[model samples]
Target chain A: MLSPLLSSSIKYYLCFMQTVIIGSGNVAYHLAKAFVLNRIPLAQIFGRNENELSKISGELNIPYSTETLQKADLYIICVSDHSVEDVSGTITTKDCLVAHTSGSLPKEILKGDYRKASFYPLQTFSKSKALDYSKIPFFIEAENEEDRKILFEIASKISDNVMESTHEKRKYIHLTAVFACNFVNHLFARAKEISDLQVIPFDYFLPLIDETVQKIHEIDPKSAQTGPAVRNDTRVLQLHEQLLQGESLEIYKTMNLSIKKMYQLP
Target chain B: MLSPLLSSSIKYYLCFMQTVIIGSGNVAYHLAKAFVLNRIPLAQIFGRNENELSKISGELNIPYSTETLQKADLYIICVSDHSVEDVSGTITTKDCLVAHTSGSLPKEILKGDYRKASFYPLQTFSKSKALDYSKIPFFIEAENEEDRKILFEIASKISDNVMESTHEKRKYIHLTAVFACNFVNHLFARAKEISDLQVIPFDYFLPLIDETVQKIHEIDPKSAQTGPAVRNDTRVLQLHEQLLQGESLEIYKTMNLSIKKMYQLP
Candidate 1:
């Protein structure tokens, strides 16, 4: 009841602390822009290359640097896989809270005397496309209770869906994502390749692709499964194998057999 | 110049002959509705089961059959794969055209004296969901030029994207579809199962799922690939493996290794 002075002091403290982004890649750029849109001051963005940093700096109208890391409330490392260790090594902060924007990397890698955490945004990012950050899920992991709360608060400010996922769980989720997204796209690319070889337009597969994705919202995949492999239509499958004679044929047969085995088709 | 009497005779022939579908599954129901909506009176839906047949018959107000196959210019067998041979066997007419709605099955499997063909719609179907068949790609294969022309005419009546794909090409396309659609859905299901076990809400993953599909429309998937294995963060990957230790662990390792190999990640 008598904490009027403390409340005003806390409000002033919050208004002054700035958030800094320490990378210029897709995740970092998107996160920084979201922060800026939320009216949070983006203190500085750092990159190894001035040219890359200039692109993001020009787009967001934020300050850029190719210099050494400085003390900030939060330092987010969003470099590539091979660059993570080296990037973290170069940062000089021993007291500031540091985090990496990675799904699979442990927060411990970024651990120094400072607090370590992860702010992994679980979405694919492209520079040309403006992402809907509110729909993206941010996986937060932090060292202590206060840091965890801070990370969650920061993530919640930008995204509606924020969860505390461990490094292990996020990794497993990432692996499943590769199977669900990346590999599926590869299959579509293969379909496009073969279709193009026969002078068939790639747009022909778009409707099928859209319908297939939409089907899962209604039924479980196992029950919704179709095709010759599931039906054990050997004659048709053999003809397909004959037509795709070579590496493409091998890929086709392997996938067919996998589906057949999964469905217990003869 | 064509003769006036010959043109009048052709008009007379077209007025009497029509396409009739023989099954009440997803494909037949949707195709019949599309035909009726397009002002084409060519759908004569037949089903062996009374309940399924009556359901579609009641909705479309089309003629339904449970015991007999009525004479039609074209009969499209849209039954289950196991029942295709039996249905074709039952409808043995020397001169009537017969086709099966299957992507994998060869046209010759109808094996009747009738000019057999395939009118495979390359898309997933659900009974409860209303599909816009005009957007669906129809792949037609026929025994002769006249049959091809007839099938093509029927396909073009509802859809703009129609192709004359051989049984072999259709089979390969069907196989590729399994990898692209069915397998991807399975991965999502598995992710749901894991999230359920962890007491995480299933809706949390929906945003990730939606974004993954959306990213493909922007760029090639190989370049858009993300996650732990691609990032080569071994520590996080090992932690994730440890978390998923059970039947799911095998799936986790296999998918992770596959992604790593695909990306040539160290």
Candidate 2:
């Protein structure tokens, strides 16, 4: 039966928001889980890795497609930043609103015969770690109004935190995240290594680490910053430098200088 | 009327454990505040700066001692790293416990006619921030069994998270904390600046920061690492390097190499 809205666009409109998530990494895993947890089921998952795709699909009870991009209302390519272009090029559907979940890449990368958009979740995703979707900021950018509205609706259903972040700003956030998340984690890794070398259990650091994060909850990062570098405590700083070696020493000195410069310490 | 314990030896014994916290810095402020809040009043506060000491003393209604370390059971010198020895030297009691709240300093620094100890709280403190004393890990070290027992009892009363850590191990933890707390906070400061320069608000990095800390709540830092450096994505690494400069660029390269070396990536 043909409805009043039935036209050449009827098929595309019917497929509009039904999603097919591509890739099976951290983002894809969590996003797929979020869809199911929110009762917004994914239509299929397209990925080249059979082992991972099969495991993910089997767990979610969604069909897995490895051959090509399946027909759906939306195709979310969750590949690495470098592969976003290549992966998006393969999904050539004029009707579907195609999006890649990358903070660094511009939405234009997904522009093709199909609709273009970005569905970046501005949070770290680890496979084993559980996270509340409602707290995760979902940054959506679409090629057009219709696609934007659809993406917004989908994102809103999945997470309470929805923002229409532009490509340019998201890129900046991505860079900052490298410092806040990635680089900070590197620091923690180094801390563990240092503690291990000194024959102290890593558990001694948990409270300090927790307090460091908890400090920023009430104060700005600048005001919350404290250490020998901030205090310009040359005695303690030199003693620490003497204890470290190689890359650890380099990072210690580099970060020390960075903190000194930040605080305008001599 | 005089009791049997009121003799000359008894006089000094009664003074033991009654604390006079020295200095009014962040550590001293929080420790004094904690003691007050916990209904355990500090006997006095000795500060070279009368203005700061008066303010804190008036707030807590504790006596402010500027002339010298007032006779007390415990004199906790919560001064700077370089001043621990000097501060400890001022207290020339024969039997009272004299401790410094310095993580880097050895208990020997407080060695004198008085009993030596360390009452280091292993957490970052800021005047503007409020923290639950129970969560702060107090690392206590003492010269004798009686002093150790007293310090443990006091620390336990203030914080459930108390440990009898040695000077050597505590020093190692302090070094690790420079990487975990101080250095990471420095990274957050840098992230905020980079984000500001790019015209992005610092709030965008908060969620990322929270998640970075949250990730470690469940897993080890090494297992939780996710970024270009861990993935060894040289393309994105170079792109990010291009956007950074000076100390930021140096930190980027230093941290990148550190991560690579840690992961043993080519």
Candidate 3:
């Protein structure tokens, strides 16, 4: 409700606070859904790709624009790492606090004549598969305390596991995430490939993979580590190497050596 | 619940329908616990080391044996992979079925005039942590139909997910487990090392790790894979490699290359 005494512009700002999400990739799509799911005043979603944009627009039943300029109190630039700066630049949002959803990019990349921050959800999100947003750890960053609070407040609304991180600390989160999420998934992929070759369904490794992750939840992965390299089982290691060739062979050897050195195996 | 037999020899076999588990290691300890938990007749546990063996004996309230030959209908050799042959050799249980719990080793390894078999549980068992044996896949194999049925009956009693796996298939499962469990855990370990160096606790990677494992349950890992390497983002890949050094760098580079090659990225 707008008060008669209040200025029209001030009343407009007070009456409605809206968010415009940029991009339509996995992170963008999931974030958009989560924002809507939480009723976070999501006004518009902008996607460069017409097909993907329409897909998101239809799914969320929200107004979307391919136009660079969209009016919203908060503009979340959720695009690829390379295009984050470009997306921020294209958003002609003024006075609004703009943030990019990137784990690696610094907050400064959000280039607009407005306050900026990086609103990074530290999790691997797939668009179709809905993630538990409340469980997702969010790393928010901004220069000013006021703007930071605004970002933090909005982020906290979505996730209980929210915290302010410096660009330095947040970037390490990105690098480490690559190892944990990306590299770990690759290991699963390689392992799956190996199983597929042997006419084994990928399901054979599910229990083992679940336990591997579950261990870190209870104990440090360092002590939870086990296998040929840790046990110094050169015979089995040789047998495994015999099955792997080319790139996988190199990976097995390299990781084996690392594991051996990490544990200082005999 | 045994009916009286006319002869002492028939009564000896009928009265002692029990299992003797050899070795007090992770697999043995967990198997012993699971057996009792399921109300299976686990009569004795044997370990070369008196200290560890006594710990298991006292905990399970089962008789501890230093002697290799403990009377039971079945003998399960649950020693290390390398020690399976030697452990099976030491067991002198005639007529009773002797099964070594090893994914890689064949049932023939068990020496003496005993019906040989393999009863491998496909999981990472830690003695301190009790696993849900019902969910763990139990792989069984035996020399003869009678011995096989005995192994199957016992394995099925503890686990619903029981299957017959030949030595050939079991070895492949063992190899794949190394890739999925051992290699995946090392990635977590390395990620933890990176986080530790930067004074960041390993909690941040927890959600991502959980999701990575979760994704495989819903979708195939090869299709479920996401990251800079799969996306062919050279920029972020280069950045990740730059942050990593020594063995970590090699691991990053090798994995990145494998992911790229696996996806047939340029």
Candidate 4:
């Protein structure tokens, strides 16, 4: 038994782990491309969208189909949060490792008697954009030790940043991402709206936006905080409040209040 | 008359523009350093803080004094927004071009007969951090065309991004920056707060944060947005909401609502 397990593990590591990617979205496309680029042989790409699946299939030179799914060493379900469970149920390969690439969902959400796991890459993905996979952080979770090691080793091939994170921790991770990435982008959109009102070209604010992100890399965000809210400059804050209306005003007020509260400023 | 003016302008450009920087703060230190780096001569560094003034003087090989401010072709009031008018009153040089480095305040606020102008560099500055000045946007405003040209030329020496903006436009620019830089940093702070609660290392989120900012450079932030709020995934949103409290909860809900409103998602 030990000889057979060791032999298979060695073979998996030596050449490439046979993998099948489910769903044809941003995450699916990017992950498939990364695997191929790293010389990891994908057995097939399975998804409901024929057009998207074909694009991934052609781009990565892998077989893809909408109908039948193939058995592989691992199956990565890269569907939406709502569809992760349903997609995970379609994989019929018993005892095979099945992982869902979700930041919020737990490994238990993947139905089946198979070894369940999560191989979450912590970055926003767009189908058209290429990314440096090596820099992206991949959070891995598995029910058992051996599967965890397997997932870790595979993730390590594409990323320098990989770690074992539990579902509880990952929920917070996803929450933080919403605040840092999603909410941050919303603020950018709001800034663009305000700039549009004044006919100030949105490009003018890009440098400041870039610098804001750049600053936090070297310093903590709390320490990196600036502007009227942090400074408690009532005059400037009031002036800004007057210029905005409706949802913009509400956002401006709420954000300012939050900032002030964070720093314990009056 | 044109020859004299042209000769003086040529001389000003050839050697260096004699400039005095008032108020030794982040803006003062950065602007002063940028001027010296671009070979623009600093006549004096004047401010109330002897330690900061001396540091700038010693580092830049320029004179420093809290006692008397010197006369120069241009006197830049790099004081805080509240102190700009007061600092402008101290510069005794009549008819010399006077400028304040302020984003929100108008050029007319420089309370003197001297040619009033605003030389606002749209970036968040830290005393210890070195920045690429060429990437920073300098918004120039002046009472006269010649002064505007002078400010533009001076700004162009250190930065490639320079624009002539009115007081009206600068106010909105400043307001938009509050959303883009200041508010964005606050969100990062809040994200860090949530991540800390779960003992998830903040560094893990840095890649996601960096990618979020990088994505916006290529696509609009509206298009770049992702997460539960954008997707309107009620399950994940509710789960995240349950974990946060107080200002964090308030921020999460408000930001999500704003995003939903922006995208017109239910």
Q: For this target, which candidate reaches the highest TM-score against the unseen true structure?
A: 4
RMSD of each: 4.0, 4.7, 4.5, 2.4
lDDT of 4 at B227: 86
Q: Candidate 4's residue-wise lDDT over A148-245, tens digit each?
A: 87778778889999998999888888889989888998899889989988888888878888888888889988998889888788888888888999
Model 1 residue B69 lDDT score: 73
After best superposition, candidate 4 residue A110: deviation in angstroms? 1.3
List ranges where model 4 is wrong by over 4 Å: A1-17, B1-17
Per-residue lDDT, model 1, residue A61, is 86
lDDT of 3 by residue, A156-179 (tens): 768888888988888788889988
Better of 1 and 2 by lDDT: 2
The candidate, 3 or 4, that scores higher on DockQ is: 4
Among all candidates shown, the one with the greatest DockQ: 4
Error of 4 at B259 (Å): 0.7
Q: State how far residue B6 of model 2 sits from its true place (Å).
A: 19
- Of 1 and 4, the candidate ahead on DockQ is 4
lDDT of 2 by residue, B191-265 (tens): 888988977777766777888888887789999999889989887788788788988899999999999998899
- Chain B TM (all candidates): 0.89, 0.92, 0.92, 0.95
Which pairs of residues have clashing backbones in candidate 2? A15-A73, B15-B73, B16-B73, B17-B73
lDDT of 4 by residue, B167-205 (tens): 888889999999999999999999998888888888888
Better of 1 and 3 by DockQ: 3
Give the runs in model 2 whose Cα sits over 4 Å from its true position. A1-16, B1-17
Cα lDDT of model 3 by residue, B1-266, tens digit: 12233234443443458888999889889898888887777778987878889998899888887865577778888887888887777766576888888877778776678888889898887766658788888888888765666667677778888888899899888888888988888989999999999988788778888998898898777887887888787787877777878889989889989988988998
**Superposed Cα deviation of residue A227, candidate 2 (Å):** 0.9
Higher-DockQ candidate of 2 and 4: 4
